[model samples]
Target: MWHFAVFLLLIYYLINRRNSKYLLYPPGPYSLPIIGNLLSVWMGLKNHKYHHKLWQSWSKIYGNILGLRLGLINVVVVSGRDMIKEVSSREVFEGRPDGFMYTMRSFGKKLGIVFGDGRPWSNTRRVALKYLRSFGYGTRSMEVIIAEECSELVKLRASDSGQPVLVNQMFNISVINILWRVVAGRRYDLNDDRVKHLCGLVMRLFRLVDMSGGIISFMPFLRHLVPKLIGFTEMKAIHASLQTFVKETIEEHKASIDIENPRDVIDAFLIEMLSNKENAFTEEELYVVSLDMLEAGMETVANTAVFMLLYLVRDENIQRKVQKEIDDVIGIRQPSLSDRSRMVYTEAVLLETLRLSSVAAMGIPHMALEDAHLGEYLIPKGTFLLMAIHDLHNGDLWEEADTFKPERFLNEGKLVQDERLIPFGLGRRRCIGEGLAKSELFMFLTHILQKFNLRIPHGDSLPSLEPVDGLTLSANPFSVIFEQRSS
Candidate 1:
């Protein structure tokens, strides 16, 4: 049986190699059979995180585009902006990965605008955009909530009395609170047992994603084998916990849904659930959709906020300028979302933060649906696509791209938004939470800065800005003092 299994795998690789027959592709290191390029690629580096220098090194040697084998999948990374746009085009890249994410799925039957395709995705995206437009995504009405959260951040920092407080916890609390209200219609204490457990589950799920070798990804049948063969008990436990949270939220929404008085996301989903019987979805879809939203909405925002906090601490000059912008525009009074436009420097700071952190370093991996030419390269159908967004963020496509100058994003020092600095991605499958996220960050960060001056603890130097190993890259354990500013 074992001999046959090995034989079958060898045959599969031979076939996949044939499928990868493309001459226009960028140069890559030599690949070996069975293991293809995995052994050589991973052998030298502990994991991809430590291998950051590898990407830069490879770019110098292999041009902007390169190919490698990620398990059974063929990963083609586009490093150049032209290549990025070419791949992101709807005609070339139409499909997405069907990873373990599909198997562990649990959310509201409605997929958040993030992962859905066809009509389901369209409906969710349209509704979300329309609803956000009305409720002030980057507008003033929504800024009230952000102001409150930032106020809390300031209060928490002041409580430290210039002592260093680990912002990982604070950052998580603020973003989670915002999402809690926006999506779930509830907020839990920062130290709440369930909140802590949820964080743990999210952290573990991300870890599983990070170190998840290509073992089971190639074949779902291998899930059982890989877990037992590799001991993925903790990952399973994390999935179980996450699944439970989604299930509980769904059940709660089902019980308390009011058709006429829809408020937060739960009520909104429930209303859609009850009103549309024929075209309606089931509880399973509901659970899965909710899970997707929680993961996308919460994960990115939390990571972005946390890193921005760390960056502000390290770069005190930027922090002071942002606070000055906030004070000039919003005054001692709380900042509403509308204030973002009035405060150019504050908006620029947020943009700079997004650029510098590059939290999702390797943009969400997408899969090609058909054979297409991206730039000069001929990409085959079903090839996995990962763009070097970190490089793009650092590239000269935009003025002052590498510099953390908010002035570049401003006109005569007035706040402005440019689509070119696209951190949320572009086209149809772009992040649905883009509008809400910008609002959350802008309103929250400026408000916090206005009330507290963020500074790294003087005792230890600031943490290096090197990326982490997980799907979401964050500054490693770093401490910052949030000294209160007199009103």
Candidate 2:
């Protein structure tokens, strides 16, 4: 009787295994029951870079598109340029996952532009683009605003030029000022306690999100059950703090809001709120949208600028080349948008910096809206998608892919553009702040290089290039000594 039962159990196991094969999920690391590939993911999160490296390895084993069962959710990681292009552009894959953590961040609803999808996302995105463009988003007028902000930053740094200065917050303050001007029609003083506190909160939020991996992201129940243990308490506090700032700003705007002549993004949004009462627009939505702008706009540009400085200071040759290009083209006059066309090497360095330090490494995750075919595999409805940007940028497609070679972006002494170089992402959901970011990067970097010679402080050791693992990759805090350059 025991032998007969053993034979029956073996038959049952085989039958289930065979049935599972017919599910048509893309190939990935074998997942255990219930927990699914959570352990593998957790291990990767422990070392932030490992998370990206693990995905790259899995891509090789499972081909370009690989799927993993991440707890209850199905995750599909798409690698390679062609695959990313195809998957990123597909409407079926454009939806963002409505996970527990995702909704909670936006006041328990999909109220913001970054994570929200469907008609609400479409409507807000459309309005935002329209108004932002009207307010000189990608134009020469925007360059003038950024240049003026850069000049203020330059004066601030000039005061302590020869000393070793921590530039992390300095970059944050400078970048935030430009966005603040665009959005609120005013800039915060660098020494303002409120600005300092806000910057600290934003940094903490990014760090917490990175450390938790998918724990805080996917499982909302843990937040309620073990709030302190899982960082949910701290996360909520940060969210509330940011929300308070946005609310206060909006209230101030409301007091002076003009229906006839809007001052900035806040005023524009308020006007829209009054005009389109029946649309998805709301006061709450405006708060979240402003939060999104400040968070996304500030971090991406600041972090990338910091990383660019880190790279240039480490390699003196690259720095000389960029500085020489700036001197030749712009000749110490404030770098403008028009000079961007002539600064070939400077442009290449910026491109390479962006490629090497992909700020939004994995980008905000995309959801599979419905069952769809990607290449040969069938991606089921509701599967979460992560564009393997880290893998795509560092793939075999680029020669010397791992090295910090700016020349890769240059050909015949001219900047060479590649479609695969998507630092700001692609498709309908590409970062709305791309143009603003590019303008800031060019203006700030050119101004800094033109004015100062960046170096590791005298008698100090070189800082580690390894980034702090976060929602966006940022260089570990380091100091640089800037010697004023003679024109």
Cα error, candidate 1, residue 201 (Å): 2.3
lDDT of 2 at 42: 72
User: Per-prediction TM-score, please?
Assistant: 0.87, 0.93
Report the alpha-carbon TM-score of model 1 versus the true structure: 0.87
- In model 1, the Cα lDDT at residue 207 comes to 46
Model 2 lDDT tens row, 1-487:
7577557655654563466432677888877554568887777656645566677777788988888876556788888778887877989988887766676668778767888888888988888878777777777778788988889888887889999998877778778888778788878877788888999899888876642245766555577678998788988899899888889999999998879999998899999888877763788788878888888888888899998888988898988888888888888577888988888888888899899888777777888888888887888788888887877787888898878898898889878998889988788888888878888899889988889999898787787777877777788888998889976
Best by lDDT: 2
Model 2 clashing residue pairs (backbone)? none
User: lDDT per model, in order?
Assistant: 0.67, 0.81
Candidate 1 — worst ten consecutive residues by lDDT sum? 101-110
Off by over 4 Å in 1: 15-27, 44-56, 101-103, 106-112, 127-140, 211-222, 226-231, 395-420
